[model samples]
Target: MNSKHQILVIGAGTGGLMMASRLKKEHKDFDIAIIDPAKTHYYQPAWTLVGAGTYDFEDTAKPMADLIPKGVKWYQDKVTAMDPDSNSVSTEKSGEIKYDYLVVSPGLTYDMSLVPGLSEAIDKGNVCSNYTDPKHTLEVLKNFKGGTALFTQPTTPIKCGGAPQKIMYLAEAYFKKHGLKDKTNVVFATNGTVIFAVPEIKETLMKIVDRKNINLKFYHALKRIDAEKQIAWYELAPEAYEHNPAKLEIEKEGNMVGIHYDMLHLAPPSVAPEFVRKSKLANAEGWLDVDHHSLQHNKYPNVFGLGDVAALPTAKTGAAIRKQVPVVLDNIEKLMKNQAADNKKYNGYSSCPLVTEYGKMVLAEFDYDNKFTPDPELKKMLIFDSSKEHWRLWILKKYGLPYLYWNKMLKGQDV
Candidate 1:
């Protein structure tokens, strides 16, 4: 109603809500507002479990109304334009709202058009994607008769870098459970050159790949899919194209390898939201241009960005956001206090709980250098080595993280 605020946050996803709730707890006197049209906030990390039928879909979501921090005015409308130069944002119905500081964590959107037939093939027939609808993926898995069970990801960045593979591992377990493992060929064809970046984690995953007999076709990017013909064509990576022709099986069609599949699950190409991509705050890559260490905008001192929307070198994950939020908060508080250039730095820390199989998980925690830096606290108190498959890690994924997210992170509690 005031058409103004001291600080305004965009999006109501993980990063946006976390920042807002904590700001509320610390700066109760500051007039803050958040703009988002979402009715329900989802714990998307659990969808990997949901797709495997290991977790309930309903448990992954909560009404957004219950989560947005109290006293932080909520604008239940989408942002049409973000004019940071003018220090104002235009909403679809609320007209213009001004802010002294803007927090952009609107997250990314699926660019289904990246691959020609991706829009038509996703969630259609044998093609299923947990990113779009985990429930639909479950149904697709239920009716899977058995053959080539292939999983792949887009060349572009996607939230949860390991998500595409997480489902593959879980689905493999499903196949083994229903006596279809013998008849099915499990394959992961990714554009990434390695199974995982961290060495210890990669070693752990490589073992799982061997045990499950899952195929890993690195340097293979999905080019297109012929839904009617049950064919998924792939373009070989540069290494395969110019150097190693043996990278692809010679028996397959030349140039583009067209593989036949019974089921295809993939992470589609994703980009910053249209509103963020088109805004002045976005980088050339269409993501918010923020300092990798401070989580502050490169050009604007009063503007901050985080979550999947920020163009940071680390993986776009909720775990990364956990480290980023505090840095953003500290910098914002310093600015509010007229403290110049005094800021906190994020070490680009992010964690990915790689669920190798049912009752088994490998925690991959690292910094900017791709070092296998386990959480010092966890390494000392919890399990010693995070890279090894631990049943306790599986419990953390299934129960611990979700409980912490809803109770601690969003509620502005440190623990």
Candidate 2:
């Protein structure tokens, strides 16, 4: 095997695979290689549906072997260290690899330790998370005995910001189906003040929150969980703490409070992978330090990043990866040819299909400024109003996006 290559991709997840495939389609003869130890590549967007028991868990995964682009050498090994200054990467199995350009997209790591007792609580049936295991989530929903079901969002950045609530909405629908709606006390506890960032979708979700009679606890972040005792602990946000204490009840240990629950669904705290987090390449927030517009490293011109790992101020989602792919590829091509780069710039575009109910979704698409930027293809054709809940968007979320991911994006079609 060659020690040096024209391009080296660090992770074979959505971003790396898409970038490699696109590069392959454009430059068939380019010396490209991808390093990853994963045997299976998962279509993570469908996990929500899987958790809701609407989609099969098996359908969300594919062998990594089947997805790698033709002629792109695959190193099935985990990366240990990156020496960008020496233009080389060190892997566990393959000692050293040199590259003219590097692409880092290992994605985030789940920090189960962020919330005390989270690791031990997840296996206890009553506490399940859709973020990690969709099957467990289904099991939890099926075995629900009906009481106060608590859905929580952590304070840290998470992939698919709408996911914490998406499953809750699905659980609500499930309760209605099984005649448990009356007995179920549905509560959504999140640290964020608003239900959603986009105004149009937030307005729509507010209506759903009211109509469904779901409890909305704003400025409440999950602090810990006593799974054995069926107690979920929370700490009030700074704003809430600063507000009049006359109305709010404070616990003896400061602003802590507890909610008794029959079932607890939590969104685990997410952070950059340990390898990336400990590296000098990472920013203050422990994410890849890259220019938001060009997708290039702020310090090193040869380094590029995208997807969940990059410090781009956008909601991390597969839809966001689709938008980031083109910009990274364009810049890489220019840099490879020794031409002045920066022609293509990413606009911080990300889309989150907020599944409000069964067969209904509000496709929230936006840019850096949090302004609604609907897909031009759908917007021009007037297929559906993305900001409103529609069955068409739900179909796209269920069927269309997965098809596009496997057949188009990873195959280098760029659409």
Candidate 3:
């Protein structure tokens, strides 16, 4: 059967769901349809706490049918093809859906198979990843008694940059609480030279690393894992000039190294899904090609995208999506009216509450320019430093944010 909508959302994830709810509320007559493969909706930001054993995995997920806005059509199927030129998307189960405007937020694809032996190691024993399914987090944490615990962040861009290190800090605190801090050697091995991209936040993080005695390794990319030997292999980044496309530069930096570990937490490489990557609307790097400020497709006027899958040069987080939803909704609405889209710009605002320990967090808020944009009331209302880990902020991340996401953000009610 032929289906058409004023706005077609390709995914029912945070970005798509938020935009659809907003559009439906703003204009009831505007037809909006959301397509997602799964019937469940997840609060992904809470996964970090789940990995730390602070939250139950079940609490972080919800029934999609309950959260999706009433009146908007929901198609429970995966997007098989995106035909932006014809303003239509084909789903695996449902047939073609035509649209006047399209909002693509399918999210990134986690490539767990990229790292050799990683799949086996993660499936075999005390290994976990907070980025994927949260159900297994508790089981993995329960087995961690002692020994060298390794946490890794890949070179590829991930949804939440701070999540890998956030779990590491939680693991450190968990060990202390369990009276096993002395027995466990916690290490953070990442491809980045610094702990975080923001200088202010990085300063605080470095101090935490020093105080906690957490081993930090830079320029180290996880190459493989050995579950039996409990050895995690890493390859150093090649020197700047050594990156000659003509030659194989695998060992230009040095020989691959290994770190023995009893438990491992990994953040895998992520990319746009193959369907979006092969579509005409996507960039060469396989992400939805949209203008950084406008959130509109560079080539296709009818297409727009946001969230982790969009080619926006900012931190890919739900916090960024909060700021982006309004921009995407407004621009698409303007296009639907046969008017030129307004020039409402996005400042690349994104936030990451760097939970260094159980009670402490370095609130890292910045934009595309890497300039800090702190909340004005945070500076005025609070006597204590907002950057420091406070019980108030912890409650905000743990309890307050989830409520805001479901009841407010998903309902088109903005704070």
Candidate 4:
């Protein structure tokens, strides 16, 4: 049935679910609906701990039916396309649905095929990724008998930029626990030059890298995975660049390097869902064309977005969704009241709980310019250190944050 509503959220993800929950609670009269085909919602942040054997895999998931707001209708359908000019979206199972206001938060998709042989090898051999399957990663980590272990971060933006290394740190700690540290040669390969974007946090992560005695290979982006050979191929990021509109001019030859590994964990390239990229509502870079501040669509005022699918120049993480939820709701409320949404602005706040070890983490929080913006209450409770590894922060990550996410954030309660 082709239906119309006051608000239609395209995905029942963190951003979409949180937005619906808040709106339904705040403005009870608004007819809001969320569409997603998935039957389970995952607490992805906990997957890192799950991969490390600290958290349970079963604990990382909840039935989507349990998490959807009580009043908002759920459309168990996949979105196929959007007609933003007419405020309607097409779905694979449910056909076309129109809305007065739309929230586009379908999130992102992983391109494991971006690297040759990765798709065939992942979650099958000693090769695994916490991103794709935490259970397999747990298996990989548990079976390690010491040797060359390499953790890789792709050239494209990933869900949590720190995830590639978070598992590396945990695996290192695991090696120590299993008496395999001395024999294991741990390596972290990334396309970026620094461990982190924020200088303060980068400095601390650098120290952790040094203390762990892990090899850091900068400008290395995964290009191929020869699982049969137990070798990984990478291309060195080119130094010179030509401002080609379509493709980059690079010297592709002589830049490839191959490394053998006993075990490997990789963060594959991620991009906005294919539907969002192909839609007219997307920005030049194939993300939702929303204002980075207001979380509102620049061209279509009735459309708003927040999450990995949105074109915000910040790290994509669930923590960012916590801050972004309120901003988007406030602006939507403003729109409801016929008031300008100019004052309601999001400063691109995002966070990465850098788990340095089994019991220590550096809670890195920052705003638009990558400035560390600590929460006053958390700072006071955590002794105001967001860049240093602390047990309290680890506790927050392991136990506290997940509780807050399920009990508060999903219920529209501010953390």
Error of 1 at 96 (Å): 0.9
Candidates in order have lDDT scores of 0.87, 0.87, 0.81, 0.86
* Top model number, lDDT: 1
Q: What would the per-residue lDDT of candidate 3 be over residues 1-415, giving only the tens digit for each residue?
A: 6699878898888898889889889888877899998878898899998878788888878999997788899998888999987888988878899998889999999776778787776644687788875556566667778888888977788988889989888888888988988887788878877787777777778778878888777888787777877777788766311110111112222567677777888887788998999999888888999999888899988788889999988899999999999988788767867887765679899989788778767778899988877777565435256556666678778887889888898888775
In candidate 4, what are the lDDT values of residues 1-415, reduced to their tens digit? 7999999998888888889999998889889999999999999999899999999999989999999999899999999899999889999988899999999888899988788898899899799999989999999988889788888977788898889889999999999999998888888777787778888998898888888888787777778888998888877777522111111112334878777888999987788998899998898888889888888898899999989999999999988989898888888788889987774568889999999999999988998899988778776664577788899999889999999999999888887
Every candidate's CA RMSD = 2.5, 2.8, 4.7, 4.9
Off by over 4 Å in 4: 238-253, 380-382
Give the clashing pairs for model 3: 361-389
Clashing pairs for predicted structure model 1, backbone only = none
TM-score of 3: 0.93
| lDDT, residue 387, model 2 | 81
Tens digits of per-residue lDDT for model 1 on 316-368?
Answer: 89989888888899999989889863565798888898888899888999888
Position 321, candidate 4: lDDT: 89
Which sequence of candidate numbers ranks them by TM-score, best first?
1, 2, 4, 3
Error of 3 at 239 (Å): 6.6
Q: Rank the candidates by lDDT, best first.
A: 1, 2, 4, 3
User: What lDDT, from 0 to 1, does candidate 4 have?
Assistant: 0.86
Q: How do the residues 22-93 of candidate 2 rate in per-residue lDDT, one tens digit apiece?
A: 999999999999999999999998999999999999999999999999999999999898888999888888
Q: Compute the lDDT of residue 238 as modeled in candidate 3.
A: 67
